[model samples]
Target chain A: MNEPYFREAEERFCELLKAYLPYEDAYQELYKTEVNNLPLYGYGVKGFTLSMIEAIMNITNNKGDLKLVEGALAIGREILGKPVELLEDVESTLKSLNGDYRLVMATKGDLLDQERKLLKSGLAKYFHHIEIMSNKNKEDFQKLINHLDCAPEEFMMVGNSLKSDILPVLQIGGNAVYVPYHITWEHEKIDHHITHDHFHQVETIKEILPFLKSQSYLTKETLK
Target chain B: MNEPYFREAEERFCELLKAYLPYEDAYQELYKTEVNNLPLYGYGVKGFTLSMIEAIMNITNNKGDLKLVEGALAIGREILGKPVELLEDVESTLKSLNGDYRLVMATKGDLLDQERKLLKSGLAKYFHHIEIMSNKNKEDFQKLINHLDCAPEEFMMVGNSLKSDILPVLQIGGNAVYVPYHITWEHEKIDHHITHDHFHQVETIKEILPFLKSQSYLTKETLK
Candidate 1:
């Protein structure tokens, strides 16, 4: 039930590093290198794979063993082959809200990866629009909303990441719902006390249904 | 005047193989390897870079030296750092069509790379929608038309690749204008005799202007 594939790749890297360094220290160093190489490689399995190779080069002092390169290739092949794992409530949430409100998927992901994942997730038909954003910044949200031809208040964003899907939307005056998954992406973990009229948090995607239904009711019946 | 950066990377890979094999032999082998890895790496600078490493491994019998990996790393870094080189008439073409047609960019490309290029290209202002498709198949075209709320005939695809941009669109009953870029992506080179009512081919992007203008004429004045 809990086989997150990226963790498998990370653990593989850690194991590869076991001969030279401690696990946590190696992980931190690897993460740092990946972050530093983000601009060059962008993101997704290919970038992750490339960063692993780069990290190996750094750790092994540019004399990275051929076997380690083999490991990196294996890691890349494994990650690329891994199937998309949709969150439990994601399909239900999309089904509930798809028709009533325009459902758009905005992701800062690899084009091939996200598109493949969308196909694999069996959730493509539920979305009115599927956008692969370069970054999830305030400007990106504003551009997305403007392109959608929807006002900020009328457009609501829902996702698991506060840093990406929440803050940027809120900053741009769009409504946002935070559906915290059990395992948050490390980069998206933020400690913020939010007290906004427009912001709401839920433990899972299913929990957001009530709030959305009521809010949409107000929008259709009251606002209209 | 033109330094297609990807070519530079290719040449570097070729040079690296000079010690072991003939130039053209090494080049063909690398090309074959890169094509094979397309499913694994997808299409992008990262994929190309990874394929080079894989090719090196293949060529060197998995006894690939550290210098080869270093060469691949440098190639990846160099390619990623290269700026967007907008075609000469692309801006002019968009400028001409922006007001009339609901211009949408449909690209089967790496999301981050395309987005970054779009931003740098500064032609983002012209497009009403930007779609990064996973593939350029007939079904992909149909889906895009459906999402755009337009009939296949109402949507016109303007692109350089005959394989990706022309055949698929024509197969889906969409209008297509092919502007042949001088440097055709090797994978997109297709020898097809296109004799269709909805297909038009031009040497340069600027040539598509008159066709599009006259098309919008038929769409607005004649048809409506």
Candidate 2:
């Protein structure tokens, strides 16, 4: 879900918001409200951006400022259009394990927009299958596993959001790697962190290679 | 799509809003704003309801009032969860044409939400395929036709929205029956009227029977 590059998008979204509002913590408030209301509105760059702007306009007492809101939305479109920078060593890393693992990019967002981003990301060639889910709850993960025809123990989930990436996968009896981003959405933050045998935290995505090398599932034939 | 009974759903949404804000034209304002912002926020009762509430809160200058907004969103969840009643003779009409034509339920909204409604409607038995698209435009329709392995002329689209249902099908050279609902979304209204040889307008879903019977493609073998 994080794709190792979405944090930059989030940072850019916040930068764009700063141009319209003078509030220093506008992004923080925006993230909190967007997460809280995500179940109601669902997920997408467009909906999330609109929600963020609506929150900012309300807090700043600029509710009637339609033009300002439009400006903010336009910025959101720009953010979505912005090229996603692949994290350091991401391409080479994924390419190395491409055949060794059934790399499926499971992401959730607006269908059209997410597809566009995946195309723009230029990293689509490394994965076996791509999923753009409407929601990433436990039910969604179960469906994905079923579609892949793999047992939960064989799946290795990796992403930046604890709520979307780590928790649900672990709850479904799958393995997961949590790569913490510098700036995370408040809503994705978990109050109670679980300690599990299959759950591993790494400083960077590259660390997952060594972790996988230690797994019995990684065979030399597939690694070739 | 309206599914015939969405007007009642819209009416229910408006009624819920009236409890929080005493504005006579609130629903109208809500609908207008919603249509205008549909492209930006995308569609689905949840997103639309959230946007409408955001608009009301903005106009009423109750920006920090999160509880009222939450209440409104809850109403939106109810709208999505509400049972959709088919138009008069809709099921029978569709059932009659069910085999004669490759009946595909093509509507746009949140994927999971739309699927839930389709399953709940118990109308899933009639259609050969059901598509809940992110957006209903020429390209989207083209993709659906391609997937169905049918030519544009072979497809007959029956839906309520002109913006989504009628125009695109006509533009793609598909036959279409316009079954106008009593309340149409403002965004779905077309600026210019279309007169095409393949297009027919009927007051109810039942009326489509005679129109389809007139078509040479409606053979006894296919119908049986």
Candidate 3:
């Protein structure tokens, strides 16, 4: 996983929300309306979707009925023309991979904007499927494994986080390769559960090719 | 910056060391040595040199006498060997760069083994100089900066640990591009001082090229 997605999403949402309403006022109102169950009287569908996604992503802990108010505010902000900077290299890196592996993206927040960006950049074709999950838990792992119909040993989770992708995959008996992201968020804590043999952490995503080549299952035909 | 070096060095040193000493006896002798006192005994000039390199690279915590001892033991176990595995790739990457910049290699520990390897592998020509220090601290930084006669801002420190490379460089107003090593030894603590700045916490050495290029400081003429 890359840092740009979450950082950009948060920034875009914050900027969009701030434009339409006073930042603090909007935060309070959204909190009361969506999270506090004060009734979202004037909010539209977009507002509701954003609130829900924010809640799922755990950005807004259920402090009150206003729990998802932050989400609604973010959604409103995103819709009002906030510029979310796209990661320029992401598409290029994805395009250059020579492997036949499916890309199931696991992210921590609402990815509607990101999904569209991928499509626009023509990177949607490379992935067999896409998944933007709020968390990396047993349920998410099982869902991913079932989707591929592959055993844990056969599956490899590649991401920039050892706390998220690597640890979860290792816990579920799957292989994981960590490509450390340049910018790590404050919330992504190091998993203390990580054993020495848990996962292979490499510096770049490109390193994955050589690692895969080392594995017996990755055939030249499949990789090509 | 990569695990292969330590692994290879460990292996090569062990193979060569074993030819001269019995493995079990070496282990018994090595285990009794103190961690901070590694360079006291000559395990093998090459083995000790590589061990020093590994130690300085922050790959292992065994310092002084114990570093050589454990390194010898590890070599005897066949877990580490001369980093022949990475020689081709390292050479290839170096070649791909087309001698764009003078490589100033700064490594922790003693420099003899690595120097020998570099010379043998024909990588010595690419580097303008190589300095091996027990630790990268204020003293070492000042010395290198003075020797190069370059401003702190003009130089970039590329290495594995944040505690060592990034923080010290940043403290002295020099830029640091961190290429995280594959395996972080237990001693390399996460620097609590790291601020949430993307410009500072570099995940790859390649990031520096573009950054330097943006400033017109990485031109062929400047490097030469």
Q: Is candidate 1 or candidate 2 better by lDDT?
A: 1
Candidate 1 lDDT:
0.77
Residue A117 lDDT in model 2?
Answer: 69
First chain TM-score for all predictions: 0.91, 0.82, 0.59
Give the per-residue lDDT digits (tens) of candidate 2, residues B1-224. 34433455556556656655555576676777676666555677645654656565555565334444544555565666676665578778877876666778887776657766787778999987677677888988998898777888778888888788888888998878888887765567888887898788988888888877787864444333
- The true-versus-predicted C-alpha distance at residue B27 of model 1, in Å, is 2.0
In candidate 2 chain B, what residue range of length 10 has the lowest lDDT sum? B62-71
Give candidate 1 misplaced runs (Cα > 4 Å): A1-3, A213-224, B1-3, B211-224
Which structure among the candidates has the greatest DockQ? 1
By summed lDDT, the worst window of 10 consecutive residues in model 3 chain A runs over: A37-46
Please provide the root mean square deviation of candidate 2 (C-alpha atoms, Å): 7.0
Task: Tell how far residue A23 is off in model 3, in angstroms.
Answer: 13
Q: In candidate 3, which residue ranges exceed 4 Å CA deviation? A: A1-76, A79-89, A96-99, A191-193, A196-198, A217-224, B1-224
DockQ of each two-chain model: 0.62, 0.15, 0.01
Model 2 Cα lDDT, one tens digit per residue, A106-215: 88777656767687789998987777787889888998898777788878798988888998999998988998877665567889886998788999989888888786
lDDT of 1 by residue, B80-160 (tens): 667787778778878877777788888755667767777787888998878877778899889888877787777778887
- In Å, residue B177's CA in model 2 sits off its true spot by 3.8
Candidate 3 to truth, TM: 0.34
CA-only RMSD, every prediction: 3.0, 7.0, 26.4
